[model samples]
Target chain A: MIEVRGISKRYGNLQAVDNLSITIEKGHIFGLLGPNGAGKSTTISMMCGLINPDQGQVLLNGNAPGIKETKHKIGLIPQSIALYEELTALDNLSFFADLYNLPASQKAERMEWSLAFVGLQDRAKDAVQDFSGGMKRRLNLAASLLHDPEFIFMDEPTAGVDPQSRNKLFESVFELKALGKTIIYTTHYMEEAEKLCDRVGVVDKGQLLALGTVDELIEQYGGESRVHIKSEQGEESFMTANPVNDLMTRLKGLTTVENLSLQRPNLETVFLNLTGKQLRD
Target chain B: MMKAVVALMKKDLKLLFKDKMAVFFTFIFPLLFAFFFGSIFSSSGGSQGLKIAVSDRDQTEKSQAFIGQLKEASEFRVTETDEANAKKLVRTGKQVAFIILPEGFGENYGGIFSGQPPEILVGIDPARKAEAGYLEGSLMKLGIKRFELAFSDANEMIKQLDFSIEDIQQSDDMPAEWKSLLGDYLPKFKELTELEIAKQPEGSDSSGLSFGSDGDNPMMPLKITKEEITVQKTGPRNSFSITIPQGVIWAIMGCVIGFAISLVREKTLGTLDRLAIAPISRTQILAGKALGCFAAQAMVVTLLFTIAYFMLGVRFDLIKLVLAVLAAGICFVGFMMFFASITKTEQSVAGMTNAFLIIMGMIGGAMIPLFAMPGWMQSISHISPVKWAILAFEGAIWRDFTYIEMMTPLTILTAIGVVTFFIGTRMLKLKQS
Candidate 1:
């Protein structure tokens, strides 16, 4: 388990990550969702030991984040495609594997497994610059696994990837979770978080506004499901607690209805309600 | 720790070479720079002419006069010493060469018609044997002027005539009849020389006897015999030998700039964050960067010097040259680190590296020869590692540096490397904090 206790970070006069805290369990996919300038990257950086927090501390399994043993146990997949573009996928993995100081007997095996896990086994010999955006993202993901890190911090892994590549990345995240590896995924896309996160944290202005399971947060902050009826005369919408049962009763009185649909509260509605719809820098 | 550092270094080198322009600048550009500048400096002796030592065994009026003429001429920088120390100066590479006038040089200063001409003995450093030819040519020019004066001066004319007559009388090589006739006619010529002197008013016009008004031949020539000797190994035989080092420094600075920019690139591109999060300490990351730069610089130095040895007729002491390259590599790596530390972006680094290196090269004699710079600039050049690097190279290659002499540049360069490295790493840590 990884625990961040009241961690805060400041840059100049700006509080990039305010006094905030979150705990992630072992073998869980925890999603962190925030708008731009919401301190997601800063929080992740502090948790991964890339930067020090101005206050409080982070502990990886009851030890400091950057301790010799603790650091080797965790891995970071930075938001950017951090793999070396000039090198082949295999070479990139080989380099990271060396940095991890993997045992000689297991080095090649782990390299092969990491590439295979990303579905890039055959493309290992190709330069990363030649890889598509999705392939690059996948390769980026593979680079972090050479040491078989227990805790993986992936920040905005699917920001600009196509739907197909995003699916591959999601599949890989699922596989990692199945293998009982803890994952902290940060993203701007609410749907990606909705699909991948076992528990999601919505933050704004360096503060966690809401935190719960996907359905639980939605039910709490996502108000009023609605049903829309399009009739020959006009269109109408009715608010209800239960759209399925209420729409059935309302539709029986509508003889001229041409189309009917139920609108249910979801994560986006919950997110907007908790963080507001204001634009962020 | 070593494994992580090595991995980082290998990765850096791979990426650096993968960029074609970086390879070109790192390996090829310096050679072109050296060649172009070498061509310019090859024929030039700089603001100062070639330094030469002179010893007059004849302490007579004409010898004094000849030495005076040498001092006035701009072609040779004259250093007058006794014959006892002339060879020592040349052997120790103090002066380019030394010229010695024999005991009878004054009496036989110029006697084209009076038999053997006065001889000037030249001792030149063997490593710089080509300079002997230059010294000889310069001496001949000074000799011709004295030869003209010898014929116009009445006393010099009488002396030459008498010496010729005495030579005929003493000659066993001359036939009896020819000897008698020449011996008889030489005195009459001597009488005419005195009468001609009587016709002249004073020392205002000392123009020598003229056969014709222009381009006339009144033969009075000085014989120059060159002897090459030195303790130094083969050195700069030509201009290219000197310029090869100039070229090498450009490439070295190029590597420095290239690596510095890459360091900033890592930060800007977010790669540094990944490395920072790794288990290895910050020291190892910096070491890896330094090693990558050193490797690039070493490859460049080796390839360039090998080309110089085979293609440019340059020779050097291998041990000293290795020391020089190592010191230079360390020094420039510090420059690389310092550059990386000061800048935050690729554009800024590129600008800083170019401006900084160009200034160092200018003042250091890497672009302009130190001999060509003003005295003030030369004095300032000591602060530039570029100058020290070149100085170390010169000591190892052509300068015939004693072990003690080699220590100056090597020590200074190493010191610069260590100091700058500390500052650079310290700055990095401060920024991280």
Candidate 2:
């Protein structure tokens, strides 16, 4: 539901995003994988109309980003928890709901559903300042969904959240996908992208290095699955260039193999192979 | 657009009310300052009655009469004393000044028309220049009245004889010897000339001028009379009344600084950015913030004035007072927005806002009355928005200003609000870009 075409952004002498292009279908979860300073947030900012790209354009369902109609259909959950600490959870939700121009009659019902969806319904009357970090993260997510925008952009929504809250957030993301909502997710963690995203794009140095599904990416850049074996003699690990069934059958005949396991190429290996394991700012 | 603006305004107000410290500074602190300063500065509610010692060494009826006149003066609190004590009182600052009449003063006073009159000894405190000047003026006026009373008939005779001598000099039938005699008397005629001259007759020639010694034709034709008329008969202004508007200015300034800091905090916390990303225009966001700050300022000012009205006996023209409060609120809201536009962080905005408020308060007569400052400082006071605010408020309160008179300050305040708001919004747009 979003199209980023030849978009490039620069900050002073540093090019933040260089000629980046990406497209997502209406009901898919697209994960943008990148290291720090990889221009992932910059691209998301351009798509949400928060920051204008230095060159090219961002179109949401054929309309430019920040066009009134397009902005009404997009929601952004920033990396930081952007809820008003001084205001109660309900007040914050009500404010964002009003900003989206939601009808007065629908605001309360929608707010109730959003609070329940994020498991913050019990503390809706409490000030957000007194909330736990995880609770605030959930409230931030809930605040974004107040108007139920069709396209949601989440930038590391679970960065500091507890594991339980992280699981809850993941479940919420999957539920949004099941409801046919398009989401653009960016994170430092590769496992989340592998578990939730329908298509993954690996970006580095302001450039897109690879874009594909889990299997497609693994086949293209991840090479082959490896077999690891441990025995009384010594531990041995090797890449199985053949099919996993043949490799397993060949390993079963070895008398020295006391332990056996088949490894599969995942999104992390694919991401590392394509973007390289290098430190970035 | 208005809906979004209203939502933003609601959020701001909510945040402000939730902050207890903000509420206290915005409303309570200024009133406390007003009460403290007001108690110290309130006048005694009447003219400053000057204390003076009077010593009548002459012991004559004329001297006694002069002393009585000084006692009868409502502005002076006169005490009869000996010359030694009078001098001692003035020296010790127990009295503003003292009047001492010498023994031969009444005897030599009648020589004013022919020779110099004896001087009256006035032992005065140099530090009390205003009181000393008043005392001197009072004595001079009394001396003139006594002079006029003592020589009324003699002065009239001198004026008539002088007029006759002038007519004789100009006559064609007069002999040269008589003309020379008139020339010899000319210098003495000038000595007899009165301090005041009446307008001459419309058609009378100089040679035929009338020189009759009429009772009404005195040497000094013009009479000088002192009459005092007060334009505003309101109660005497005490420190409380004067400080009421000043207190209101402080409240408005506090609101401005508080909200300006809040805006910077929101920007730093990413709340402002989140709002910007919504389906709302930049104008809506700014308008919302301005409206919120304006409302808070107006509420604080109103609360302060209400307390002042009941507790301090401050009077007001209800409608004009409301308008003045609104104008001040708008002006400070514009100031808040302007400060927010220029500063990036909460610390920077807070520092600048405090400095600006204190400087404006000091110069604008909020901390001290403008009239008490030097002439140059008073002139510079007009450049402050706080000065215009205080002026507008005073117009509604004790100044008894009419609607037309009130318009000058009100218009100035409104203009400041408008111009600052425009510039602030433009700067904000540029910053955003």
lDDT values for all models? 0.85, 0.81
lDDT score at residue B161, model 2, on the 0-100 scale:
50
lDDT of 1 by residue, B1-433 (tens): 8999889889889988899998888787888877777767675646577788899989998888899998988888899998878888878878888888888887667564556678888887667756777777888887777656766566767777777888778888878888888978889978876775666567545355443335233444533468987865465667776787888888899889989998888888777877887788888989999999998888899999998889877888999999999999999999899989999999999999999998999899887766668999999998888999998988887888998999999999999999889999888767764
Assess candidate 2 and give its lDDT.
Answer: 0.81
lDDT of model 2, residue B175: 76
Q: Candidate 2 docking: what grade?
A: acceptable
Structure candidate 2, residue pairs in collision: B41-B239, B42-B238, B42-B239
Interface root-mean-square deviation of model 2 in angstroms is 1.1
Please state the Cα-based DockQ of model 2 relative to the true two-chain complex.
0.48
By summed lDDT, the worst window of 10 consecutive residues in model 1 chain A runs over A272-281
Structural similarity to truth (TM-score) of each candidate: 0.76, 0.75
Clashes of 1: 1
lDDT of 2 by residue, B1-433 (tens): 8899888888888888888888778788888888888886664546665788889889987678777877887778899999899989988879888878888776556444332476688777577777777777767776776556543444444544565555666667777887777667754654443312222354432231123444243445454577988786674255677787888888788789888998888778767767877899888889999988988887777788788888888878999999898778778888998999999999999999999889999999998876678999989999999888888888888778899998988899888888888898899877664
